[model samples]
Target: MKSQEVIFVGTRSGLRLVLDAEENIENLKRVLERRLQEAVGFYSGARVTVETRGAVVAPEWIEEVRSVLAHHGLSMDERGWDGASAGSADGGASAGREPEAPPDGAGQDQSLPGADTVLIRRSLRSGQSVSFDGNIVVMGDVNPGSEVCAAGDIVVFGALRGVAYAGANGSADARVIALRLTPTQLRIADKITRSPDDEVQAPSGPEMAYLRDGAIVIEPWTTHLGAVFGV
Candidate 1:
């Protein structure tokens, strides 16, 4: 089944699940397993919150659900019941602690290199703007007039003829990579560069753009270079 086939049940506030099927407990588990196998990489390391409907669910049932999810590497959290809340167990607000937001100006976690990356397996069309405060990886083409901006780096597995900005949060070390390096405008940190007005031959293989001598330069994606010097 496709990703859209998964249903998100909102029985109560703040708890939801992407369920593959809705039926008996055994059937639900089987559906979930099948879905997980279809897209294992996409769901890996993802934290999911689940909310039980108004049903008076026992702790054992919850535990069984948790076990099934955990087997597929899914983490779950429940929405606490409080006073007068419609989904509250005792018709009262949940006594659970409130959730905290990420720190202000954190933009994205640059310290944890892997945590900052986003993987998109879909093509980006015109009028689409993807802004991430960290690294971004697109396994599809970035069509013209579309924009992809990141504070860290950008890796496009397909053609890139749109606007792309890397190192948006003043990261001069950030880079922009793509299979076809043709863009309306490219920026790294504080510097900006654009394709020449004259049509140039497009490179067939992957290419990377980084800072060089206070400017942005595009280079072939090869391993011959020891280290990139000067930014």
Candidate 2:
């Protein structure tokens, strides 16, 4: 199989296998199975996300991919399966349904773990996205043109250049964190804000993005910041 035909990306969120849109699903599965066997144990017990973002495969074929992954010791963990996300992969939006609404006074306890959390270990490239109904932790950067949206807090251990929306379910209390907090756009619940256009670059240490009053604010990330937000 060609390298781009079936690519596997490792993220803190788990191992994401992105299948090319043009490839035949049957051929894709066979190619994937062979590749998995060759790289045995590389993705053991890892929760997997199949990215057919722009692919034509229907809901049933995704099951085939899942089965193929299961054959290679990889399967989606039930705990990490956000209710809103399943076979749908278009920027984390669920297929044919509206995102569920959060409870009243939702942001009161952002750390309550009311939903599932997903981790991606690598930086997101252009046009790639990850969405979930719970917290999302990306171990790498989120490059420009990519996006990460979550119903809860979003934590990127690396830079965030594209866009990120936290509290997607409408919790103004949701937060965004990154080693470099410069985002083209930052969103919390229903509000939206962009990074300053000043010449000053991002600070040396980590930064936190949260809602202060009616605007989004970025502050130096510290050990106790989570406590301040009840996260």
Candidate 3:
């Protein structure tokens, strides 16, 4: 399977899946499965538009591709390559459902990584950087000099001593949360703040940062804060 045979492309609207129309259906299935498995749950609950580069595709072959994508928790856009709703080989129309975003005003729990969310299982070292179109969850620490930027929210299960920018896409509602929130710098949307002059100390509990009156505010994360964040 060539790398170009199964490609995942990111766009302003969302993710796109480009397939080689000339490739064997079985081969495409195998390659697509392998690629989706590599990302695992990262792309789950996401809808993707399929592109075949103007090549005509057979219904059975397309069904095979759709099955593979479904196995990985992805749905094909109803308006596919030709920008029109398409039916299945059996002449049945399959509705494409967009992934649901977190409820308005409520912060999504980091435990349940959702659509467009990237889960990093390992700690980031100095000079490391991560940029994503959606939410970012670090299972481990983000060391000093590292950087993380997300279009949505940013969550660190362990210490966060590095730089973090949430709402990179200009979403003022986005937030940043960490178990130990002593970052070199933090930014939520257009608001930015740096560590205090005081020496960095361990936090009593997890902390969260969000925009307030056009400024960034850091506070201890509490269970009842759902009123502030919705969830």
Q: Could you tell me every candidate's TM-score relative to the true structure?
A: 0.50, 0.51, 0.52
Name the runs in model 2 displaced over 4 angstroms.
Answer: 1-114
Identify the superior model by lDDT, candidate 2 or candidate 3: 3
Error of 1 at 52 (Å): 46
Model 1: which residue pairs collide?
15-51, 81-93, 81-94, 82-92, 82-93, 82-94, 83-92, 83-93, 84-92
What root-mean-square deviation over C-alphas does model 3 reach? 11.0
TM-score for candidate 2:
0.51
- TM-score: the better of candidates 1 and 3: 3
lDDT by residue (tens digit), candidate 3, 182-207: 99999876577999988866788999
The alpha-carbon lDDT assigned to residue 229 of candidate 1 equals: 35
Q: Rank the candidates by TM-score, best first.
A: 3, 2, 1
- Model 1 stretches astray by more than 4 angstroms: 1-115, 225-231
**lDDT assessment of candidate 2:** 0.69
lDDT of 1 at 42: 34
Which pairs of residues collide in candidate 2?
A: 11-120, 11-121, 11-122, 12-119, 12-120, 12-121, 13-119, 13-120, 13-121
lDDT for 56 (candidate 1): 43
Q: Report how far off residue 140 is in candidate 2 (Å).
A: 0.8
After superposing candidate 3 on the true structure, give the runs of residues whose Cα lies further than 4 Å from its correct spot: 1-114
Q: Lowest summed lDDT over 10 consecutive residues: which window, candidate 2?
A: 98-107
Over 77-184, each residue of candidate 1 has an lDDT whose tens digit, in order, gives 443211212444532213222222211122132153224789989989999978775789999999999988876789999998898887664557778889888988
